[model samples]
Target: MECCAFCPTESRELYKCPKCDRLYCSLKCYRNEKHWICSESFYKDQVKEHKPELMENEPQPEDSSSKNFNPEMFEDYMKTFKKDTRSEKEKNPQIRVRADEDILFDSDDEPDYVRVVAEKSLEEFEKIDMNDLDRKLTMAGLGGLTDNDEQLEYLYSQLNDEEKKMFNRLADNLQYDEMGLMNSVFGKNLPKKK
Candidate 1:
Protein backbone atom coordinates (compact mmCIF):
# COMPACT_ATOMS: atom_id res chain seq x y z
CA MET A 1 0.00 0.00 0.00
CA GLU A 2 1.36 3.40 -0.93
CA CYS A 3 1.26 6.25 1.58
CA CYS A 4 -0.49 9.50 0.83
CA ALA A 5 1.86 12.10 -0.68
CA PHE A 6 0.35 14.99 1.29
CA CYS A 7 -0.30 13.15 4.55
CA PRO A 8 2.22 10.98 6.35
CA THR A 9 0.18 7.79 6.44
CA GLU A 10 -0.16 4.53 4.53
CA SER A 11 -3.55 4.38 2.84
CA ARG A 12 -5.49 1.42 1.52
CA GLU A 13 -7.41 3.76 -0.77
CA LEU A 14 -5.86 6.89 -2.30
CA TYR A 15 -6.89 9.11 -5.14
CA LYS A 16 -4.36 10.72 -7.43
CA CYS A 17 -4.48 14.43 -8.03
CA PRO A 18 -5.27 14.77 -11.72
CA LYS A 19 -2.94 17.72 -12.25
CA CYS A 20 0.18 16.49 -10.43
CA ASP A 21 -0.54 12.77 -10.00
CA ARG A 22 0.04 13.04 -6.24
CA LEU A 23 -1.67 10.49 -3.99
CA TYR A 24 -3.98 11.81 -1.28
CA CYS A 25 -6.04 9.88 1.19
CA SER A 26 -9.12 12.12 1.18
CA LEU A 27 -10.62 15.36 -0.13
CA LYS A 28 -9.32 17.15 2.97
CA CYS A 29 -5.76 16.03 2.19
CA TYR A 30 -6.13 16.97 -1.45
CA ARG A 31 -7.50 20.39 -0.52
CA ASN A 32 -4.82 21.06 2.07
CA GLU A 33 -2.63 24.16 1.67
CA LYS A 34 0.33 21.96 0.79
CA HIS A 35 -1.56 20.49 -2.15
CA TRP A 36 -3.83 23.39 -3.08
CA ILE A 37 -1.75 24.51 -6.07
CA CYS A 38 -2.12 21.19 -7.87
CA SER A 39 -5.73 20.87 -6.72
CA GLU A 40 -6.58 24.32 -8.08
CA SER A 41 -4.86 23.56 -11.38
CA PHE A 42 -6.83 20.31 -11.63
CA TYR A 43 -10.06 22.23 -11.10
CA LYS A 44 -9.18 24.71 -13.84
CA ASP A 45 -8.34 21.86 -16.24
CA GLN A 46 -11.68 20.22 -15.41
CA VAL A 47 -13.55 23.44 -16.21
CA LYS A 48 -11.78 23.69 -19.57
CA GLU A 49 -12.53 20.03 -20.32
CA HIS A 50 -16.22 20.59 -19.62
CA LYS A 51 -16.55 23.37 -22.20
CA PRO A 52 -18.48 22.49 -25.39
CA GLU A 53 -16.50 21.55 -28.48
CA LEU A 54 -15.52 24.85 -30.09
CA MET A 55 -15.73 23.95 -33.76
CA GLU A 56 -17.39 21.34 -35.91
CA ASN A 57 -15.50 19.73 -38.79
CA GLU A 58 -17.05 21.94 -41.44
CA PRO A 59 -16.00 21.41 -45.03
CA GLN A 60 -13.54 23.87 -46.50
CA PRO A 61 -14.23 25.50 -49.87
CA GLU A 62 -13.25 23.41 -52.90
CA ASP A 63 -11.11 26.23 -54.27
CA SER A 64 -7.59 26.61 -52.84
CA SER A 65 -7.00 30.21 -53.96
CA SER A 66 -7.25 32.99 -51.34
CA LYS A 67 -9.18 35.15 -53.85
CA ASN A 68 -12.06 32.68 -53.65
CA PHE A 69 -12.94 33.80 -50.08
CA ASN A 70 -16.52 32.97 -49.16
CA PRO A 71 -18.31 35.15 -46.63
CA GLU A 72 -21.03 32.53 -46.01
CA MET A 73 -18.44 29.91 -45.11
CA PHE A 74 -16.71 32.36 -42.77
CA GLU A 75 -20.04 33.23 -41.13
CA ASP A 76 -20.75 29.57 -40.46
CA TYR A 77 -17.31 29.08 -38.96
CA MET A 78 -17.70 32.23 -36.78
CA LYS A 79 -20.81 30.63 -35.33
CA THR A 80 -18.55 28.15 -33.59
CA PHE A 81 -17.17 31.00 -31.46
CA LYS A 82 -20.67 31.41 -30.08
CA LYS A 83 -20.24 28.09 -28.26
CA ASP A 84 -17.96 29.87 -25.77
CA THR A 85 -19.70 30.59 -22.44
CA ARG A 86 -17.37 33.34 -21.31
CA SER A 87 -19.42 36.42 -20.38
CA GLU A 88 -16.61 38.84 -21.17
CA LYS A 89 -17.24 38.25 -24.85
CA GLU A 90 -20.93 39.03 -24.40
CA LYS A 91 -20.13 42.32 -22.65
CA ASN A 92 -17.39 43.51 -25.03
CA PRO A 93 -16.87 41.36 -28.07
CA GLN A 94 -13.50 41.37 -29.79
CA ILE A 95 -14.87 39.53 -32.75
CA ARG A 96 -12.80 39.44 -35.89
CA VAL A 97 -14.66 41.59 -38.43
CA ARG A 98 -13.93 39.89 -41.76
CA ALA A 99 -12.76 36.82 -43.63
CA ASP A 100 -10.16 39.00 -45.36
CA GLU A 101 -7.33 38.01 -43.00
CA ASP A 102 -7.50 34.75 -41.07
CA ILE A 103 -9.72 32.63 -43.28
CA LEU A 104 -8.17 33.92 -46.50
CA PHE A 105 -4.64 33.32 -45.22
CA ASP A 106 -5.19 29.81 -43.84
CA SER A 107 -2.80 27.40 -45.50
CA ASP A 108 -4.43 24.44 -47.27
CA ASP A 109 -1.98 22.02 -45.71
CA GLU A 110 -2.77 23.06 -42.11
CA PRO A 111 -5.18 20.80 -40.21
CA ASP A 112 -8.51 22.20 -39.08
CA TYR A 113 -7.75 21.41 -35.44
CA VAL A 114 -4.51 23.41 -35.56
CA ARG A 115 -6.29 26.42 -37.06
CA VAL A 116 -9.03 26.22 -34.44
CA VAL A 117 -6.53 26.13 -31.59
CA ALA A 118 -4.53 29.00 -33.07
CA GLU A 119 -7.64 31.15 -33.46
CA LYS A 120 -8.86 30.47 -29.91
CA SER A 121 -5.42 31.16 -28.43
CA LEU A 122 -5.21 34.45 -30.35
CA GLU A 123 -8.69 35.54 -29.23
CA GLU A 124 -7.94 34.68 -25.60
CA PHE A 125 -4.52 36.31 -25.81
CA GLU A 126 -6.02 39.56 -27.11
CA LYS A 127 -8.44 39.66 -24.18
CA ILE A 128 -5.62 39.61 -21.66
CA ASP A 129 -4.60 42.85 -19.89
CA MET A 130 -0.82 42.72 -19.66
CA ASN A 131 -0.70 45.20 -16.76
CA ASP A 132 -2.55 42.85 -14.42
CA LEU A 133 -0.37 40.29 -12.66
CA ASP A 134 -3.09 37.64 -12.29
CA ARG A 135 -4.20 38.01 -15.90
CA LYS A 136 -0.60 37.84 -17.04
CA LEU A 137 -0.11 34.58 -15.13
CA THR A 138 -3.34 33.21 -16.57
CA MET A 139 -2.26 34.13 -20.11
CA ALA A 140 0.96 32.24 -19.47
CA GLY A 141 -1.12 29.16 -18.44
CA LEU A 142 0.17 29.47 -14.86
CA GLY A 143 -3.13 30.75 -13.42
CA GLY A 144 -3.03 28.11 -10.70
CA LEU A 145 0.04 29.78 -9.25
CA THR A 146 -2.10 32.82 -8.38
CA ASP A 147 -3.42 30.90 -5.38
CA ASN A 148 0.08 30.32 -4.03
CA ASP A 149 1.70 33.58 -2.94
CA GLU A 150 4.98 31.92 -2.03
CA GLN A 151 5.30 30.23 -5.40
CA LEU A 152 4.38 33.38 -7.32
CA GLU A 153 6.92 35.42 -5.39
CA TYR A 154 9.56 32.76 -5.94
CA LEU A 155 8.82 32.69 -9.64
CA TYR A 156 9.17 36.45 -9.94
CA SER A 157 12.33 36.39 -7.87
CA GLN A 158 13.94 34.05 -10.41
CA LEU A 159 13.52 36.59 -13.21
CA ASN A 160 15.90 39.53 -13.48
CA ASP A 161 14.57 43.06 -14.14
CA GLU A 162 14.98 42.91 -17.93
CA GLU A 163 13.39 39.47 -18.29
CA LYS A 164 10.55 40.51 -15.99
CA LYS A 165 9.88 43.59 -18.15
CA MET A 166 9.97 41.50 -21.31
CA PHE A 167 7.56 38.94 -19.85
CA ASN A 168 5.23 41.76 -18.85
CA ARG A 169 5.15 43.03 -22.43
CA LEU A 170 3.88 39.75 -23.89
CA ALA A 171 0.73 40.17 -25.99
CA ASP A 172 0.77 43.93 -25.58
CA ASN A 173 -0.59 43.83 -29.12
CA LEU A 174 -1.46 41.25 -31.74
CA GLN A 175 0.16 41.08 -35.18
CA TYR A 176 -0.60 38.35 -37.66
CA ASP A 177 2.47 36.76 -39.24
CA GLU A 178 0.47 35.98 -42.36
CA MET A 179 3.26 35.22 -44.78
CA GLY A 180 5.32 33.30 -42.20
CA LEU A 181 2.45 31.04 -41.10
CA MET A 182 1.32 30.31 -44.67
CA ASN A 183 4.86 29.77 -45.91
CA SER A 184 5.70 27.31 -43.11
CA VAL A 185 2.65 25.17 -43.86
CA PHE A 186 2.41 25.66 -47.65
CA GLY A 187 6.18 25.82 -48.32
CA LYS A 188 5.63 29.17 -50.08
CA ASN A 189 3.61 32.31 -49.42
CA LEU A 190 0.53 32.67 -51.55
CA PRO A 191 0.75 35.89 -53.54
CA LYS A 192 -1.72 38.58 -52.54
CA LYS A 193 -3.78 39.84 -55.51
CA LYS A 194 -3.02 43.48 -56.29
Candidate 2:
Protein backbone atom coordinates (compact mmCIF):
# COMPACT_ATOMS: atom_id res chain seq x y z
CA MET A 1 0.00 0.00 0.00
CA GLU A 2 3.03 2.29 0.00
CA CYS A 3 2.68 5.20 -2.41
CA CYS A 4 5.29 6.78 -4.74
CA ALA A 5 7.75 8.95 -2.73
CA PHE A 6 8.02 11.73 -5.31
CA CYS A 7 4.38 12.89 -5.72
CA PRO A 8 1.55 14.08 -3.43
CA THR A 9 -1.06 11.83 -5.12
CA GLU A 10 -1.05 8.14 -4.04
CA SER A 11 -0.06 5.49 -6.62
CA ARG A 12 1.03 1.82 -6.51
CA GLU A 13 2.91 2.07 -9.79
CA LEU A 14 6.42 3.09 -8.74
CA TYR A 15 9.93 2.83 -10.20
CA LYS A 16 12.89 2.57 -7.79
CA CYS A 17 15.88 4.77 -8.62
CA PRO A 18 19.03 2.61 -8.97
CA LYS A 19 21.41 5.23 -7.53
CA CYS A 20 19.45 6.73 -4.61
CA ASP A 21 16.93 3.86 -4.05
CA ARG A 22 14.00 6.35 -4.01
CA LEU A 23 10.56 5.71 -5.56
CA TYR A 24 9.05 7.77 -8.37
CA CYS A 25 5.61 7.45 -10.01
CA SER A 26 6.72 8.19 -13.57
CA LEU A 27 9.83 8.91 -15.71
CA LYS A 28 8.95 12.64 -15.43
CA CYS A 29 9.17 12.44 -11.63
CA TYR A 30 12.41 10.46 -12.01
CA ARG A 31 13.98 13.37 -13.90
CA ASN A 32 12.46 16.11 -11.71
CA GLU A 33 15.14 18.16 -9.88
CA LYS A 34 12.95 18.82 -6.79
CA HIS A 35 12.60 15.04 -6.22
CA TRP A 36 16.32 14.36 -6.99
CA ILE A 37 17.95 16.99 -4.72
CA CYS A 38 19.31 14.34 -2.26
CA SER A 39 20.31 11.77 -4.99
CA GLU A 40 23.69 13.47 -5.66
CA SER A 41 24.17 13.91 -1.90
CA PHE A 42 23.55 10.16 -1.40
CA TYR A 43 26.10 9.25 -4.08
CA LYS A 44 28.66 11.68 -2.56
CA ASP A 45 28.06 10.25 0.94
CA GLN A 46 28.57 6.69 -0.42
CA VAL A 47 31.90 7.59 -2.09
CA LYS A 48 33.12 9.41 1.04
CA GLU A 49 32.12 6.47 3.28
CA HIS A 50 34.00 4.05 0.97
CA LYS A 51 37.28 6.01 0.72
CA PRO A 52 40.43 4.56 -0.88
CA GLU A 53 42.22 3.70 2.42
CA LEU A 54 39.09 1.92 3.81
CA MET A 55 38.62 -0.35 0.76
CA GLU A 56 39.63 -4.02 1.19
CA ASN A 57 41.94 -5.32 -1.55
CA GLU A 58 41.25 -8.62 -3.35
CA PRO A 59 43.48 -11.55 -2.16
CA GLN A 60 46.83 -11.21 -3.88
CA PRO A 61 48.35 -14.34 -5.45
CA GLU A 62 50.40 -16.06 -2.72
CA ASP A 63 54.17 -16.34 -3.13
CA SER A 64 55.33 -19.98 -2.93
CA SER A 65 58.40 -19.05 -0.83
CA SER A 66 56.51 -16.83 1.74
CA LYS A 67 56.49 -18.27 5.31
CA ASN A 68 52.72 -17.61 5.68
CA PHE A 69 52.13 -19.73 2.54
CA ASN A 70 49.27 -21.93 3.65
CA PRO A 71 48.75 -24.82 1.22
CA GLU A 72 45.90 -23.50 -1.01
CA MET A 73 45.40 -27.08 -2.25
CA PHE A 74 42.08 -27.42 -0.34
CA GLU A 75 40.86 -24.03 -1.58
CA ASP A 76 41.78 -24.93 -5.15
CA TYR A 77 40.03 -28.32 -4.80
CA MET A 78 36.84 -26.74 -3.38
CA LYS A 79 36.95 -23.52 -5.51
CA THR A 80 35.85 -21.66 -2.35
CA PHE A 81 36.27 -18.19 -3.77
CA LYS A 82 36.39 -16.50 -7.18
CA LYS A 83 39.85 -14.87 -7.48
CA ASP A 84 38.53 -12.63 -10.27
CA THR A 85 34.81 -12.27 -11.07
CA ARG A 86 35.00 -8.75 -12.48
CA SER A 87 35.99 -7.92 -16.08
CA GLU A 88 33.15 -10.24 -17.09
CA LYS A 89 32.61 -8.41 -20.44
CA GLU A 90 35.94 -9.98 -21.47
CA LYS A 91 34.50 -13.44 -20.52
CA ASN A 92 31.16 -14.43 -22.15
CA PRO A 93 29.55 -11.92 -24.56
CA GLN A 94 25.80 -11.26 -24.68
CA ILE A 95 23.43 -13.01 -27.09
CA ARG A 96 20.91 -10.91 -29.04
CA VAL A 97 17.82 -11.97 -31.05
CA ARG A 98 15.66 -9.81 -33.32
CA ALA A 99 11.90 -9.78 -32.69
CA ASP A 100 9.75 -11.23 -35.48
CA GLU A 101 6.17 -9.80 -35.92
CA ASP A 102 5.06 -12.74 -38.12
CA ILE A 103 5.81 -15.27 -35.35
CA LEU A 104 3.54 -13.40 -32.85
CA PHE A 105 -0.12 -14.39 -33.05
CA ASP A 106 -2.75 -15.67 -30.54
CA SER A 107 -4.69 -18.96 -30.95
CA ASP A 108 -8.40 -19.22 -29.93
CA ASP A 109 -7.75 -22.66 -28.45
CA GLU A 110 -4.83 -25.00 -27.76
CA PRO A 111 -4.16 -27.98 -30.11
CA ASP A 112 -7.02 -30.29 -28.89
CA TYR A 113 -5.17 -33.66 -28.62
CA VAL A 114 -4.89 -33.58 -24.79
CA ARG A 115 -8.46 -32.27 -24.39
CA VAL A 116 -9.86 -35.07 -26.67
CA VAL A 117 -8.00 -37.84 -24.80
CA ALA A 118 -9.09 -36.51 -21.38
CA GLU A 119 -12.75 -36.36 -22.51
CA LYS A 120 -12.63 -39.95 -23.85
CA SER A 121 -11.00 -41.23 -20.60
CA LEU A 122 -13.67 -39.49 -18.51
CA GLU A 123 -16.42 -40.99 -20.70
CA GLU A 124 -14.92 -44.52 -20.26
CA PHE A 125 -14.93 -44.09 -16.45
CA GLU A 126 -18.55 -42.86 -16.54
CA LYS A 127 -19.54 -45.92 -18.68
CA ILE A 128 -18.32 -48.37 -15.95
CA ASP A 129 -21.26 -50.21 -14.13
CA MET A 130 -21.50 -49.99 -10.30
CA ASN A 131 -21.50 -53.87 -9.98
CA ASP A 132 -18.15 -54.12 -11.86
CA LEU A 133 -16.75 -51.20 -9.85
CA ASP A 134 -17.87 -52.84 -6.58
CA ARG A 135 -16.28 -56.16 -7.70
CA LYS A 136 -13.04 -54.31 -8.45
CA LEU A 137 -13.17 -52.65 -5.02
CA THR A 138 -13.69 -56.11 -3.36
CA MET A 139 -10.78 -57.60 -5.35
CA ALA A 140 -8.60 -54.73 -4.23
CA GLY A 141 -9.39 -55.59 -0.52
CA LEU A 142 -11.19 -52.27 -0.04
CA GLY A 143 -14.80 -53.57 0.12
CA GLY A 144 -15.25 -52.66 3.82
CA LEU A 145 -12.88 -49.65 3.71
CA THR A 146 -14.97 -46.62 2.69
CA ASP A 147 -13.60 -43.28 1.34
CA ASN A 148 -13.28 -40.27 3.70
CA ASP A 149 -16.19 -37.93 4.63
CA GLU A 150 -18.12 -38.97 1.47
CA GLN A 151 -18.50 -42.62 2.59
CA LEU A 152 -19.32 -41.41 6.13
CA GLU A 153 -22.19 -39.39 4.57
CA TYR A 154 -23.30 -42.43 2.53
CA LEU A 155 -23.35 -44.62 5.70
CA TYR A 156 -25.36 -41.93 7.52
CA SER A 157 -27.91 -41.96 4.63
CA GLN A 158 -28.59 -45.71 5.23
CA LEU A 159 -29.71 -45.04 8.84
CA ASN A 160 -33.48 -44.96 9.72
CA ASP A 161 -35.20 -41.73 10.80
CA GLU A 162 -34.85 -42.39 14.56
CA GLU A 163 -31.28 -43.68 14.16
CA LYS A 164 -30.40 -40.65 11.99
CA LYS A 165 -31.68 -38.33 14.76
CA MET A 166 -29.43 -40.13 17.30
CA PHE A 167 -26.48 -40.02 14.83
CA ASN A 168 -26.95 -36.28 14.20
CA ARG A 169 -27.22 -35.71 17.98
CA LEU A 170 -23.98 -37.63 18.60
CA ALA A 171 -22.23 -35.95 15.66
CA ASP A 172 -23.26 -32.55 16.99
CA ASN A 173 -21.84 -33.42 20.43
CA LEU A 174 -18.48 -34.70 19.10
CA GLN A 175 -15.72 -32.27 18.11
CA TYR A 176 -14.00 -33.17 14.79
CA ASP A 177 -10.47 -31.98 15.67
CA GLU A 178 -10.33 -33.11 19.32
CA MET A 179 -13.10 -35.19 20.87
CA GLY A 180 -12.16 -34.14 24.39
CA LEU A 181 -14.97 -36.08 26.08
CA MET A 182 -16.66 -39.40 25.32
CA ASN A 183 -20.43 -39.19 24.71
CA SER A 184 -22.16 -40.86 27.70
CA VAL A 185 -24.83 -42.29 25.30
CA PHE A 186 -22.07 -44.27 23.46
CA GLY A 187 -20.51 -45.37 26.80
CA LYS A 188 -17.04 -44.60 28.33
CA ASN A 189 -14.94 -46.25 25.57
CA LEU A 190 -16.21 -44.91 22.24
CA PRO A 191 -15.61 -46.80 18.98
CA LYS A 192 -12.49 -44.92 17.74
CA LYS A 193 -10.29 -45.82 14.72
CA LYS A 194 -6.92 -47.27 15.72
Candidate 3:
Protein backbone atom coordinates (compact mmCIF):
# COMPACT_ATOMS: atom_id res chain seq x y z
CA MET A 1 0.00 0.00 0.00
CA GLU A 2 1.22 3.48 -0.80
CA CYS A 3 1.49 5.96 2.09
CA CYS A 4 -0.25 9.34 1.98
CA ALA A 5 2.09 11.92 0.44
CA PHE A 6 1.10 14.49 3.07
CA CYS A 7 1.17 12.40 6.30
CA PRO A 8 2.84 9.03 7.06
CA THR A 9 -0.32 6.87 7.11
CA GLU A 10 -0.65 3.82 4.84
CA SER A 11 -3.53 4.96 2.65
CA ARG A 12 -5.95 2.07 2.13
CA GLU A 13 -8.31 4.41 0.28
CA LEU A 14 -6.58 7.09 -1.74
CA TYR A 15 -7.53 10.17 -3.74
CA LYS A 16 -5.25 11.53 -6.41
CA CYS A 17 -4.81 15.31 -6.41
CA PRO A 18 -6.33 16.88 -9.53
CA LYS A 19 -3.53 19.41 -9.97
CA CYS A 20 -0.40 17.59 -8.76
CA ASP A 21 -1.64 13.92 -8.92
CA ARG A 22 -0.16 13.23 -5.47
CA LEU A 23 -2.08 10.71 -3.31
CA TYR A 24 -3.63 11.98 -0.09
CA CYS A 25 -5.66 9.96 2.43
CA SER A 26 -8.02 12.53 3.92
CA LEU A 27 -9.37 16.10 3.63
CA LYS A 28 -7.06 17.18 6.49
CA CYS A 29 -4.02 15.76 4.72
CA TYR A 30 -5.21 17.33 1.46
CA ARG A 31 -5.33 20.75 3.17
CA ASN A 32 -1.91 20.26 4.81
CA GLU A 33 1.10 22.57 4.27
CA LYS A 34 2.81 20.35 1.69
CA HIS A 35 -0.32 19.67 -0.38
CA TRP A 36 -1.99 23.09 0.09
CA ILE A 37 -0.63 24.57 -3.13
CA CYS A 38 -1.99 21.72 -5.24
CA SER A 39 -5.29 21.72 -3.30
CA GLU A 40 -5.74 25.46 -3.95
CA SER A 41 -4.90 25.01 -7.62
CA PHE A 42 -7.29 22.05 -7.85
CA TYR A 43 -10.09 24.20 -6.38
CA LYS A 44 -9.32 26.93 -8.89
CA ASP A 45 -9.29 24.45 -11.75
CA GLN A 46 -12.65 23.03 -10.67
CA VAL A 47 -14.17 26.52 -10.47
CA LYS A 48 -12.82 27.32 -13.92
CA GLU A 49 -14.19 24.06 -15.33
CA HIS A 50 -17.64 24.56 -13.82
CA LYS A 51 -17.81 28.27 -14.68
CA PRO A 52 -15.69 28.78 -17.79
CA GLU A 53 -17.64 31.90 -18.81
CA LEU A 54 -15.96 33.72 -15.89
CA MET A 55 -12.71 33.64 -17.88
CA GLU A 56 -14.30 34.34 -21.28
CA ASN A 57 -15.97 37.54 -22.54
CA GLU A 58 -19.76 37.84 -22.31
CA PRO A 59 -21.59 36.54 -25.36
CA GLN A 60 -23.09 39.06 -27.79
CA PRO A 61 -26.87 39.25 -28.20
CA GLU A 62 -28.60 37.74 -31.23
CA ASP A 63 -29.07 39.90 -34.36
CA SER A 64 -32.14 42.19 -34.41
CA SER A 65 -33.16 40.45 -37.67
CA SER A 66 -34.82 37.80 -35.41
CA LYS A 67 -37.30 40.46 -34.14
CA ASN A 68 -39.98 39.07 -36.49
CA PHE A 69 -41.11 36.44 -33.95
CA ASN A 70 -44.04 34.08 -34.57
CA PRO A 71 -46.26 32.72 -31.73
CA GLU A 72 -47.57 29.86 -33.97
CA MET A 73 -44.00 28.73 -34.63
CA PHE A 74 -43.22 28.74 -30.87
CA GLU A 75 -46.43 26.72 -30.19
CA ASP A 76 -45.37 24.12 -32.76
CA TYR A 77 -41.89 23.98 -31.20
CA MET A 78 -43.35 23.40 -27.70
CA LYS A 79 -45.66 20.62 -28.96
CA THR A 80 -42.74 18.81 -30.63
CA PHE A 81 -40.56 19.27 -27.51
CA LYS A 82 -43.25 17.83 -25.21
CA LYS A 83 -43.91 14.89 -27.54
CA ASP A 84 -40.23 14.04 -27.74
CA THR A 85 -39.66 14.34 -23.96
CA ARG A 86 -42.68 12.16 -23.09
CA SER A 87 -41.69 9.51 -25.64
CA GLU A 88 -38.08 9.50 -24.39
CA LYS A 89 -39.19 9.02 -20.76
CA GLU A 90 -41.57 6.21 -21.72
CA LYS A 91 -38.90 4.51 -23.88
CA ASN A 92 -36.33 4.30 -21.05
CA PRO A 93 -38.39 3.14 -18.03
CA GLN A 94 -35.41 1.10 -16.75
CA ILE A 95 -33.43 4.30 -16.13
CA ARG A 96 -33.53 4.94 -12.37
CA VAL A 97 -31.16 6.25 -9.70
CA ARG A 98 -29.14 3.76 -7.64
CA ALA A 99 -28.17 4.13 -3.97
CA ASP A 100 -24.89 5.91 -3.30
CA GLU A 101 -21.93 3.71 -2.31
CA ASP A 102 -19.75 4.47 0.71
CA ILE A 103 -16.28 4.45 -0.89
CA LEU A 104 -14.59 7.07 1.29
CA PHE A 105 -11.60 5.94 3.40
CA ASP A 106 -10.80 7.53 6.76
CA SER A 107 -7.07 7.99 7.34
CA ASP A 108 -7.70 9.18 10.94
CA ASP A 109 -8.56 5.55 11.85
CA GLU A 110 -4.82 4.72 11.76
CA PRO A 111 -2.11 6.18 13.99
CA ASP A 112 -0.23 9.11 12.51
CA TYR A 113 3.49 8.98 11.76
CA VAL A 114 6.02 11.80 11.30
CA ARG A 115 6.77 12.94 7.77
CA VAL A 116 9.69 10.84 6.52
CA VAL A 117 10.71 12.69 3.39
CA ALA A 118 11.18 16.46 3.18
CA GLU A 119 10.52 16.51 -0.55
CA LYS A 120 9.15 13.85 -2.90
CA SER A 121 10.95 12.96 -6.12
CA LEU A 122 9.22 12.54 -9.47
CA GLU A 123 10.17 9.65 -11.77
CA GLU A 124 10.57 10.80 -15.37
CA PHE A 125 9.30 8.54 -18.16
CA GLU A 126 10.19 8.97 -21.87
CA LYS A 127 6.81 7.84 -23.22
CA ILE A 128 3.52 9.54 -22.26
CA ASP A 129 0.28 8.04 -23.58
CA MET A 130 -1.90 10.75 -25.08
CA ASN A 131 -5.42 9.32 -25.05
CA ASP A 132 -7.09 11.77 -27.49
CA LEU A 133 -5.35 10.56 -30.69
CA ASP A 134 -6.76 8.69 -33.72
CA ARG A 135 -7.89 5.01 -33.79
CA LYS A 136 -4.39 3.94 -34.88
CA LEU A 137 -3.05 5.25 -31.54
CA THR A 138 -4.64 2.26 -29.72
CA MET A 139 -1.84 0.00 -31.05
CA ALA A 140 0.71 2.40 -29.53
CA GLY A 141 -0.91 2.21 -26.02
CA LEU A 142 -2.81 5.48 -26.55
CA GLY A 143 -6.48 6.64 -27.08
CA GLY A 144 -9.30 6.99 -24.52
CA LEU A 145 -10.40 3.33 -24.50
CA THR A 146 -6.82 2.05 -24.18
CA ASP A 147 -6.15 4.50 -21.33
CA ASN A 148 -9.33 3.37 -19.50
CA ASP A 149 -8.31 -0.31 -19.84
CA GLU A 150 -4.84 0.42 -18.47
CA GLN A 151 -6.26 2.39 -15.54
CA LEU A 152 -8.81 -0.29 -14.64
CA GLU A 153 -6.13 -3.03 -14.77
CA TYR A 154 -3.76 -1.04 -12.53
CA LEU A 155 -6.50 -0.28 -9.96
CA TYR A 156 -7.78 -3.89 -9.96
CA SER A 157 -4.25 -5.16 -9.31
CA GLN A 158 -3.95 -2.84 -6.26
CA LEU A 159 -7.11 -4.21 -4.56
CA ASN A 160 -7.15 -6.92 -1.88
CA ASP A 161 -9.27 -10.13 -2.13
CA GLU A 162 -12.35 -8.59 -0.53
CA GLU A 163 -11.97 -5.43 -2.60
CA LYS A 164 -11.45 -7.54 -5.70
CA LYS A 165 -14.73 -9.38 -5.04
CA MET A 166 -16.57 -6.08 -4.55
CA PHE A 167 -14.96 -4.66 -7.67
CA ASN A 168 -16.05 -7.71 -9.73
CA ARG A 169 -19.61 -7.42 -8.39
CA LEU A 170 -19.71 -3.72 -9.34
CA ALA A 171 -18.28 -4.49 -12.77
CA ASP A 172 -20.92 -7.20 -13.32
CA ASN A 173 -23.68 -4.78 -12.28
CA LEU A 174 -22.30 -2.11 -14.62
CA GLN A 175 -22.11 -4.58 -17.52
CA TYR A 176 -25.72 -5.67 -16.96
CA ASP A 177 -26.88 -2.06 -16.78
CA GLU A 178 -24.95 -1.14 -19.91
CA MET A 179 -26.49 -4.02 -21.87
CA GLY A 180 -29.99 -3.10 -20.69
CA LEU A 181 -29.45 0.56 -21.66
CA MET A 182 -28.15 -0.42 -25.11
CA ASN A 183 -31.07 -2.74 -25.75
CA SER A 184 -33.58 -0.11 -24.68
CA VAL A 185 -31.95 2.69 -26.74
CA PHE A 186 -31.80 0.63 -30.00
CA GLY A 187 -35.40 -0.67 -29.54
CA LYS A 188 -34.15 -4.30 -29.66
CA ASN A 189 -36.49 -6.95 -28.28
CA LEU A 190 -38.63 -4.25 -26.65
CA PRO A 191 -42.05 -5.19 -25.22
CA LYS A 192 -45.00 -4.12 -27.39
CA LYS A 193 -47.00 -1.18 -25.99
CA LYS A 194 -50.51 -2.24 -24.94
What C-alpha lDDT values do all the predictions have? 0.64, 0.62, 0.62
Estimate TM-scores for all models. 0.25, 0.23, 0.26
- 1 versus 2: better lDDT goes to: 1
lDDT of 1 by residue, 21-73 (tens): 88989889988878766766677566667852532343344443654343444
Worst 10 residues of 2 by lDDT: 100-109
Clashes per model (N, Cα, C within 3 A): 0, 0, 0
Off by over 4 Å in 1: 51-194
Best TM-score among the predictions, by candidate number = 3
> Looking at model 1, which ten-residue stretch has the lowest summed lDDT?
171-180
lDDT of 2 by residue, 55-140 (tens): 34534454434545434355652353446655434353462324442221234244466688789999999999888888888798
Candidates 1 and 3, the one with greater lDDT: 1
Cα-based lDDT at residue 140, candidate 3: 78
Report lDDT (Cα) of residue 94, candidate 1.
59
**lDDT, candidate 3, 1-194, per-residue tens:** 88998888895789888778889899999988676567666776877899987747533223435544332443643443324336433666565533553222354333331122212212222233344344557567554454668778876898999999887888776886776654565677765332
